[model samples]
Target: MDRPQIPLNALRAFESAARHLSLTRAAVELCVTQAAISHQIKSLEERLGVNLFRRVPRGLVLTDEGAALVPVLTTAFDRMSDTLDRFMDGRFHETLHVGVVGTFAVGWLMPRLRAFEALHPSVDLRIYTNNNRVDLAGEGLDLAIRFGDGSWRATVAERLFSAPMSPLCRPEVAHVLASPQHLEGQALLRSYRADEWPRWFEAAQAPCPPLRGPMFDTSLALAEMAAAGHGVALLPVRLFATYLENGRLARPFEAEVETGSYWLTRLHSREPSPAMRAFREWLVDAARAADERPDLLRENALSATDQSL
Candidate 1:
C-alpha cells in the first residue's frame, strides 16, 4: 500500500486559505493571484476526494476536514520556520535556556556571564532567574542552578558547592551578642524553611529562639533586611561578600550549620545538547577553580565576624 503523493504547493494553498478563510487573503499572503490560489486548492480537493471549504454568503468557512487539517499544517510550518531561523551567517546557533536561583544569579553568575559568552560565541544563552522553585520540563529549561540537598525527583543533580548557613546582622545588633544563646532576645528574621534557625541553634549548642519577625522568599531580600538593621538573619554568608566587605552586614557569630549545598541539575530525560554540555563543563570548571583559590568566603566571613567582635 502506498500513500498518495500530494504537491506541496497545493497543500500550502489549502493551509493558507483555511487559516484566513478567504482565498483572496491567502493569495495576498502567498504572493499569488486569487485564481491561482483557487486552482491549487481545487486540485488538492480533487486529489483528496473531500470538500475542504464551504463558500458561505459573507466569506469562506472550513468544513470538518479543513478544520482538522489546518492545525496540523500550522504546527508543521511553525516548527520548520523555527528550525530555519537557527541558521545565521553560516552557523547554526544553539539556544540554551537555563534557570538560576536569584542569590546565585546576582552574586555569582552575573559576574561570570561574559566569560561564557566569549568562550561560546555560537550559543544563544537565555537565563531565567527563580527563587529556588522551578520546573525543568514545564518551564522548558535546559539546566537549573539550584540550592538544596541534591535530591530532586527525576533530576540529575551535580554538587556545585556547600553554602554554610550562619547568623548575619547589622553592626549595632552584633554588639550585644556574646554567644549563640544571646540571639534568643533578638528579632530573628527567617526564610520559608522552618528548621534553619533550629538547625543552626543545634549546631551552636543553644536553644532555638522563637521566630517572630518577617519571612522572605529569597536570600537577597533577607540579606538586605539584615543589612538594614531589621534583625538577625541566618544566611549563606559567602554569597553576600559585597555587603560584608562594605560594612552593611556582619556575621555576629562563628557557629554555622550545613543546611544544604548548591547543585547543577537537569531533567533525567533530557539529553544534553552541545550548548548545554558546554555550559555544564564551564560551570563545573569555574566552581572547581573557585574552590582551589584561597578561601575568600571563609576569610570574608571571619573578617566580618572579627569586625563585629
Candidate 2:
C-alpha cells in the first residue's frame, strides 16, 4: 500500500490555527498573513476530503476531524524537537549510566555530581541507586559503585577508599555510652552483614552482645534509624560526616573496624568509553583529596607525637 503525500507546511498551519482557535493568532505565531493560514488549512481539508474547521462569528471551531489530527501532530512535533535539541555544535550527546549503592549515592556521589556535570558537559550522566547488591550486566549498567572487598566474579574493581564501620547513635544515646562496655546493654541496630557489629566490638576491645536487632539492607536507612534514637548503628563515618557534623548522629568511641572498601567496578569483559575513563580518573582524585583532610592530617601528627613520647 502507498501513502498519500501531505505538505508539512499545511499540517503546521492547521495545527497552529486549531490550537489558538483563531486564524489571526495562528498567522501572528507563524509570522504569516491571515489569508495564508486560511488558505493552507483549506487546502489541507480539501486534500483529506474533510471539514477541519467551521468559521464562527468571533473565532474558529475545530470539527471532529481537526480535533483527532491535532494531538497526533502535536506529539510528533514535540518528540522531533526534543531529539534535535540533543545535538549541540554537530556533536551527539553521550549518556553514561551508573548504578551506585544507596549509601554512597546519597552520602557522597550526589554531592559531587554538580562538579562532574560542570567539567563534562557533553556527557549526560544518569545514576541509579541500589542496595550495594547490583548486577552490572543484567541491569544494563555501564559501571557500579559498590561497597565490598572488590572480588566479584567476572568484574574489574578499582578501590576507592576504606570506610571503616563505627558505632553511631543520637546525642542522647552517646551521652549514656561512656565506654565500649556500655554498648552491651543498648539496642544494637544491625545490617545484613552479621559480622560488622562483632568486628567493631573487637576493635573497641568490648564484649560483643547477643546478635539481636532489626536488620537493614542499606547503611543510609540504618543511619536514619540511629538518628531517630532507635538504636546504635554501626555505620561508615566518612560517608555520614554530615549527620555527625549536624549533631543528628554521634560516634561514642574512636575505634573503627575496617571490614571492606568502596570500589568502582564494571564487567571485566567490557571496554571503557571516554566518559567512563574521565569519570574514573576524576573519582579517584576526589577520593584521594577527601582522604587527606586537614583534620585527619592533624590527628595523624598527634598520634605520631604521642608514639614518639
Lowest lDDT block of 10, candidate 2: 300-309
Q: How would you encode candidate 1's per-residue C-alpha lDDT over 105-216 as one tens digit per residue?
A: 8888888899999998889999999999999999999999999999999999999888888888887788788889898888888999999999999999998877886789
Q: Rate the local accuracy (lDDT) of all candidates.
A: 0.89, 0.86
Model 2 Cα RMSD, 1 decimal = 6.9
Model 1 bad stretches (over 4 Å): 304-309
The CA lDDT at 218 in model 2 is 88
| Per-residue lDDT value at 249 in model 2 | 79
**Best candidate (score: lDDT):** 1
Query: Mind giving the per-residue lDDT tens digits that candidate 2 earns over 146-263?
Result: 9999999999999998887778888777877878989878889889999998898888887898978579998988999999989999988778877876678777777889999999
Report the lDDT of model 1 for residue 118.
Answer: 94
Model 2 pairs in collision: none
Runs with alpha carbons beyond 4 Å of true place in candidate 2: 1-85, 294-309
Q: What's the CA error at residue 255 for candidate 2, in Å?
A: 0.5
